[model samples]
Target: MIKLTERQDKILQIVKQNGPITGQEIAVKLSLTRAALRPDLAILTMSGKLDARPRVGYFFNENYEVKRQAEKFLHQQVIDYKAHPIVVDKSTAVYDAIVQLFLEDVGTLYAVDSRGHLAGVVSRKDLLRATLGNKNLHELPVSVIMTRMPNIFTIRPDATLLEAAKKMIDNHIDSLPVVKEVEEQRNTYFLLGRITKTTITRAYLEIMER
Candidate 1:
């Protein structure tokens, strides 16, 4: 959606109320000349706020309102809204990882190498699967069961929130690691933060409230 000027917003409100209204009538309501409204009218139409007809006047496009709301978060960058990441060392025992997961109240955990670089991702299901038929979870390391790099789905700090949401939905996952690439290092990235389904939900709610 285009950035709406103050006058364009007024024009939109006017068309919404009285459309199929002509430009001349809109100008009359605003106490302005038709010539003066020409620019604003053209901007509104071009921005998809209003639709025009041959003889009838400009009509507000109601569907565009839905798109306008959607645009609120689509272009929002991830760096501004990521949450603190829950991290565990790759060598951390499965039992400890499970305890950390419960303590943090998160569905997934990021496993980082000693350099604070992301190595793998651990989920609740992964931990649970590792516990099956194994009474000695303390002896098992999370690295043994975690989804390692090259198989992990990660988002960059510069990515859009919409991209993050789409990734979660498409992968049927709950969260993603927000990473910053390590310079001069291949297949390595520093764990920066996390983005979750809850995060996106909160963002949408905030946008709606505003």
Candidate 2:
């Protein structure tokens, strides 16, 4: 939350790119006297944005800034980064589901009921396990193995990125089904999109680059 002056900002950027750098070297880069740059360096160090040592010189406080940025980015809504849902009908055969899984190249697939409402979640492991001893992949319904509603962990479009990330981590899942609860029905959730680990990684990279 610290507001840095333009010169201080430039100094921070310089230190970030090329540190541990000497004050003398930084001064030369800025074409400013060492004396002129002292105050800015002191302010940045005291504010915990930079770290200094007698022999090591100055370095950008990478951890603190990255942590702060992560905290800020976590509050961003999931809807902003949610990707289109790759879904299958609840009755879709396990073999067909496996085909869609490979064709879409996604780890998880949302299964919808005949009404097109989210009914269950199918994962690669589920399909693989199903195929282990079972010979009839053609007769197997994905719904039989899919994790059903109420047991599935889901996120709303309005939920924070942090919420989605935490849910995935806590549940040891690679993705979350983004859903909208129906007004009249309590158990039904309309699938909106998916929030995956890939989605979170992309969002983090976008924030870092900015």
Candidate 3:
């Protein structure tokens, strides 16, 4: 993340609030030279915090705008961008899980119980650590090394993208499980999708341009 100076932050605020505006106007109001302002603008755009359009000027990326609007816009809902989650039964062998991870090229895998409810998460690191000295990969069950339920981070379908981003940052986790509430079953949950840090960054850029 690019660190912004006080002046830079003020400049961004001005542009976000009243942009598609000219640099001269911004300079005059902020009491800065056009040459001085140039570097700030370049940095903002480079950091994915601002976008400059030719004739349209610059505008605040909608993703960074936290205020709620009624318009049908992007928001964090797992089904919207989650890829088909690769899952393995708790009974799956460690060797098989490693094979799946390589084939899928994902950092983590979801472990589901017999009922299809989320049981645990097995990251690639976990599998590697578990297989370090063991020769019985085929006999070991994934359940032995998985991050169990109640410890897993999850998000609902209606949450905003900002909320999801904050959660991921706070946990220092790369991905999240998107689970849906069953209509008739109160205690059970079904994994609908998954979200990643890359997903959030891409969506943030897309919304900001609007």
Native RMSD of candidate 1 (Å):
3.9
Better of 2 and 3 by TM-score: 2
Off by over 4 Å in 1: 1-13, 73-81, 129-141, 158-174, 197-210
Worst 10 residues of 3 by lDDT: 65-74
lDDT tens readout by residue for model 3, 50-159: 77888676666666434433233444565676767889998999999999999999988999999889889999888989999666999899999999887888887667
User: In angstroms, how far off is 196's CA in candidate 3?
Assistant: 0.6
**Per-candidate TM vs. native?**
0.72, 0.66, 0.62
Query: Which of 1 and 3 is ahead in lDDT?
Result: 1
Candidate 1 lDDT by residue in tens digits, 145-193: 9999978889999999989999999998899999988999878999999
Cα displacement (Å) at residue 42, model 2: 29
Residue 157 alpha-carbon offset, candidate 3, angstroms: 1.6
- Cα error of candidate 2 at position 123, Å: 0.3
Evaluated against the true structure, the overall lDDT of model 2 is 0.92
Q: Please give, for residues 49-159, the per-residue lDDT of candidate 2 as tens digits.
A: 999999889999988877777777867899988999999999999999999999999999999988889999999999999999566999899999999998999999999
Model 3 residue runs over 4 Å out of place are 1-76, 182-187, 208-210
Q: By TM-score, how accurate is candidate 2? A: 0.66
TM-score winner, 1 or 3: 1
- Give candidates' CA RMSD values in order: 3.9, 7.2, 13.0
* Model 1 local distance difference test score: 0.90
